[model samples]
Target: MGGLLLNCDIGESYGAWTMGLDAEVMPYIDCANIACGFHAGDPSVMRKTVALAVAHDVTIGAHPAYPDLVGFGRRSMVCSAQEIQDLLHYQIGALDGVCRAQGAKVSYVKPHGALYNDMMANPAQLRAVVEAIARYNPQMPLMLLAMRDNAAAQAIADEFGVTLWFEAFADRAYDALGRLVSRNLPGAVHHDPETIISQALTLSRGEALIASDGSELLLAAQTLCVHGDNASSIAAVQRIRQALGKTSAS
Candidate 1:
């Protein structure tokens, strides 16, 4: 086990499509992975999110995604590794520039949606993202989904001299292989408050969970992510934070 951090995917709102409870969820998280304009944010939205994170004294992170504004970056795309690296660099720079304006810099980078999934399952894409992170700022940590097979991923990150931050879903279900269950699946997300808190506590204690396939899933993580897009997501984060606080005190 390692130090625990609560993080959230935030600043997803676009021009007129408000997507998340950014203001309500900012205070409960340790880090904010703000959208970098390609997937879900605009210039004004990015600025607002940066200001909100600064106001809450939260660590700022870049949430870069594939250029799929229509599918909300959830749909996978086919591109070369060089292209992946370039787009990632572009998105990260966008957020980094925004944070610098507010005297808060990007401390880490987390690829959003399809890009994130692609990196987890595809070696070429993973290398591309890690390479981009290393080239842009070696000190900036790259966030990846926590899994039983992170040793291999860690090795690739180490090759680039990029720090790997394993992250887990606080309210989402996992498959037998420790990957997140597809969103289309039933019971893919746990909405019950107590269940979410219990899962968080179990992870803090270095325990594994039974996956959807009735197999053990190791979700070792340094950070737990709570999605803020859905309703009541803010309350869920609040409760989980309180539970984590008590664990820290004890």
Candidate 2:
């Protein structure tokens, strides 16, 4: 339980349009997945978020996507493997530069939205992502979803010599196969604090979690994610830390 790193997506604000309670949520999380300009952040926002993460002593991670700013990087793009690698390298470097300027470095990489989903499902795209990360910096860990069946990508990650950090979501539902339930599905995103906290506890202890169709999956987690952009979810983050602290003590 103590080993699980609590992570949240932040720095989503682009230009004057702000997104996420970055400052309010920073204190509670161990890692900050900062948007790297492709999705929701600008250069200035990235700088500010990097400073915030540094101030809070949180791990900084680059959250890169398919350069879909209008769709907030949730829309998939058709691109070659080489193109994907280039965009990823560019995003990671942009964030890493900001981190370096602020005396904090990007410690990891995590694909955002559609790119994340695609990579998780397609071996070719997943290989491209792994290659990008390893080429950018092999020392930086790659954060990935920990599902019931994850061996294929794990093997690929090993082949590329990239470390994988498996994460389970605290407020999202998973399918019977241990994949995250689609956002389009009813009740895919949970809002109940108790339910979210319970799952967080289950995952931290490496226990079985009930899937959307009432199946069970045992997901191992080195880190856990909670969307901290909303006020309610931010509050859940505080409670989760408190609950995990209690469990650690017990």
Candidate 3:
């Protein structure tokens, strides 16, 4: 709470399939954007992740996605606003139930994968998401990508009386428009620890980033999104935590 909060997508293990070093990374992250059933997590996984988060005092956030288990919710699907709203309600409710059993509750909402991209690129999808959050719990903040110009998204959230938490990636390259560079493209993700930590520090200081198109992009973000899927990613998160701590303390 003292500085830019760190969040990670976690609890993505399915039956007989495991993903992410949840326990190893939970201690370093401030928020957990746990996967709901539609994406990767099952009931058991959700409950376990919620308990772990509660134990670590990390905030739980519902990571809802399009009903695409095969694609890990990264494939876009055709869905109306109403359908999207329904999906949001169903996923959030399921995760909230799991959290309740563990004496914890989801503190925020963050769409996953393709849904996240669609919402940022489509105003209609964004409005539907905002509306869903407002109706579900106006107090709950919706976490979305922070861009060079957040005014449009902010206006939509303002209309619904919903709080928005602009998020930035510390390890991903951004396009000139401030959207993340496509993962399919080369150099979309930063692999070097120095580059990742440097980007984190720059964002924490509200400094400009060199976009893929060589433009200076400033993202006004309230939180930083980090990954912890494997040993290397976990190590990066640790380095980010340490680097940010030094920056905050100074």
lDDT of each: 0.87, 0.89, 0.93
Pairs of residues clashing in candidate 3: none
Instruction: Please give the distance, in angstroms, between residue 158's alpha carbon in candidate 2 and its true position after superposition.
Output: 0.6
**How do the residues 21-114 of candidate 1 rate in per-residue lDDT, one tens digit apiece?**
8888887888899999988999899999999999878888999999999999999999899999899889988888888898989999999999
Error of 3 at 186 (Å): 0.9
**Strongest candidate by lDDT:** 3
For model 2 the TM-score comes to: 0.96
TM-score of each: 0.95, 0.96, 0.97
Cα lDDT tens digits for candidate 2, 1-250: 2488898889999998999899888988898999999988999999999988888788889999988889999888998999999999999999989988878899999899999999998899999999999998898889999989889989999999999999999889999878899999998988898899999999888899998888888898899998777888888888888878823110
Residue 125's C-alpha lDDT in candidate 2?
95
lDDT of 1: 0.87
lDDT of 1 at 132: 89
lDDT of 1 at 36: 95
Question: Which consecutive 10 residues in model 3 have the weakest lDDT in total?
Answer: 241-250
Give the least accurate 10-residue stretch of model 1, judged by summed lDDT.
Answer: 241-250
- Looking at candidate 2, the ten consecutive residues that score lowest on lDDT are 241-250
TM-score of 1: 0.95
**Pairwise lDDT winner, candidates 2 and 3:** 3
Deviation from native of the Cα of residue 207 in model 3, angstroms: 0.6
